[model samples]
Target: MSLFQLQFIHRHRIVRLDDVPPQRTLLEVLREDLQACDAKEGCNEGDCGACTVVIGEPRDDGIHYKAINGCIRMAHSVHGMAIWTAQDLTQADGTPHPVQAALRDHHATQCGFCTPGFAMSLFALYQNKVCPQQAITPETAQHYLSGNLCRCTGYRPLVDAACSLNDSPVVTPDDVTLRTQLSKIEPRGLSNDNPYLQPHTLAQLLHLRRIYPQAQLIAGGTDVGLWVTKQHKQWLRIIDVTQVRELQNIDTQTTHVRIGAAVTLEQAWATLACERPELKRFWHRFAGLPVRNSGTLGGNIANGSPIGDSMPLLIALHADVVLAREEAGQVVERTMPLEHLYTGYRQNCLLQGEVLAYIDVPRPSANEWLRVYKISKRQEDDISAVCLAIQLKRDAQGVVLDASIGVGGVAATPVRAHQTQACLQGFAWDEARVKVAQQQLQQEFTPVSDMRASASYRSQVLVNLLQRAWYESQDMRCITLETLA
Candidate 1:
């Protein structure tokens, strides 16, 4: 198929387009071409959920409804899937959807700017949770609505609207027809003439990587979208990683979990957090549900954002990355520690034609005590000034045996604190030793001053966080923001 040609299901009907730009975003198509302004363009970046939309990905089991930022979603990425905009929620007979009714009855919307996005996010949650009779709590509602921002409404009404779904039940339209139609779509490859290349298999992906050496690879578009929307940059070619088949699997083994490159952060973090119960809070703090649903964990690692939350946690977990390429009709794979993947700021050692295929994360041992801290201005839906993940093992006599420390937002790339780890090793795991090591931790990195934080503040927070970890290690109660939540 021609790369410019696009086809998908919209509002229970098939839609097709020709000569669509290779990098045209879904929001641009909806607002500019179709005049569907329900998904408004606010930030254009993924942060503000004003352009939230629910996409239905048809799987063998059923249709997986995901809420994603439409502003940043490339139109080519949604070629085979079904899209649900906020305007499509009304029933055929003009009956408002239960979600819409609940929001109206509760007066959850004020100024009406963010209401559609909230409704779309709630629609995704309703289809996934309400259809299966899952109990939806206020926490669940809050989690789903994290991406949405309302300047007027205090959010109590919105939370109440989400929580009230089960109280007043309504019938959901049957999706058997939609399901049958979408499931029949056989995956197709974009033409070589196509600037946006989507390959279904890892081998094909690698082959295309070699052919299009200058083509930027995009998985979730969380990072690349910003360059287009904010920086106003355009690329002649883009290689989409989401369609690659083997890159979407998550295989759990006896000791560790292998996450594919296209696995969304929501699914990947949940799977990884299953083994480590302590990771639940940390993973939830990664982003709002919509961003998490669309963004991929492997993409985050491949992005090598110095302030990325996953790298520090993965580095502490002793994760390894499998870089692969197609050679002689066979896959050539090389494994390296996750921290070693990045060489400098926003730079990775991935050679041309070599793509990051899998991330192998080892499970934490029983002897290890893991502590993850994200210091940001806001409690949630914010970027981190300093993200720290510490894992320690100590002897029965309370002497430190080994230590693993990974930190972000203080280095050019996500880095492991080798000197800090060494300082903590072979010493008594107590207040006095922790105090001594705190100075070393602060001196390990020269953090640059930015809008988020000053270099001095980042250093002092590292020391304070280490002290907090020590205080808790001694069985003393240390109150955290999450503890209050």
Candidate 2:
């Protein structure tokens, strides 16, 4: 098959590139090639959202606009989509957009380095607002603006601007034109006989994996982007799976929710939160909006980071991961418990040429009670010092029928607290049983000390977290450190 030209709509015109490097990020292309410097490169990684841009694609309803970090997104991934930067929001006559005007009216700019990214993020939210809606609250604005950070401490005015957007007339995109333009550019399979290969289907992906077994598989490039920015290590070849339609599916089964490997964290959490509303708070803390918008659930699990918040929660829920590989001109699929998938620190059971296909999470039963807790230095957009997830079932007498406890950042990999779970099973749901389980949890793993917390502190926190879970399981109000003081 011949290599197809990378085509995308930028600033209302089609831009085509044939010789773009595979490793080139969208941020580099915007600043260096297109001279669209409004999307500033703050950290050169996805952490700082100064490189935020809104990408619109044709959906069933209309154009779906999403705010993503341009620093980690590959230049080729935007093919067949409409790319919008902060500069694109201005009218042809040079009038400021509604979001830009609102920010200016609310005095949301200081130093002005982060304003463009913030405006673009707000632009996406503004464009996608549902009809017959109430006014956007400050809390809602804060949630949407969480990804874009400003060093000048200018959040109050920015949040005010976000809330006041609804007061003005809603500006709708040219959906008919955008959808028509996007449909013209078919989803191209990109391969330049180079290391970067983006296959449009699962068959092509597995075939390419067989051809390039050593190529690094990247979904959203959230963690891989850090390697290039911080470690300065260049990957010889990269297979981007984000383009594979089969791996981007979210299927609702009668007994389980099957989430594709390439499904972004934002989409997976939205579906998961519907059945398990307890995870709503935990989902928000998974990362800032931009990271969640770009990062994939499968990428997070396959990275096998000990502190990865998703694994522990999934482990507690008894999720299974599906692994796939092409063999004898057919696809071979294998499903295993998510806990057993991880072997050690940043390690997994995936064999060479095999790829994670989907994560099958069982729907919560009516009797099941689930809770997840994350202890971090910062409340938003920070790695967990220690994360805990507990799933419990009780009988009519309040006797523990079953228990699953998963812990992270205190073990080589996210691990199930087998001893603690065993200790809690068949015990009465009372303070005495929780105390014994807490003791078992402390002795289950010898956590290493690091910058986040000391080994002793992690051990103690495990015990306290168990107690807190017990308090929460009952009707009693739990006292946290902040409230105690």
Clashing pairs in 2: none
> Where does candidate 2 have its weakest 10-residue lDDT segment?
128-137
Residue by residue across 1-485, what tens digits does model 1's lDDT show? 45477778888777778788877889998888878899988988888799999998877777889899988888888988899888999988998999999999999988999889999999988998898888889999988888998878559999999999977576664678887767665454567788778899898899999878889899888888787788877888889999888999999887888999899999999988887888899888899888888889889999999999999989988899999987787889999999999998989999878999999988767788888899999888898999999989888887889898999999999999999999989998888788888989988899988999999999999999999888877778878888878
What is the C-alpha lDDT profile of model 2 across 154-181, one tens digit per residue?
A: 9999988988888876666778988888
Model 1 residue 352 lDDT?
Answer: 77
Name the lDDT of candidate 1.
0.88
State in Å the error of residue 420, model 2: 0.4
TM-score on alpha carbons, each prediction: 0.97, 0.95
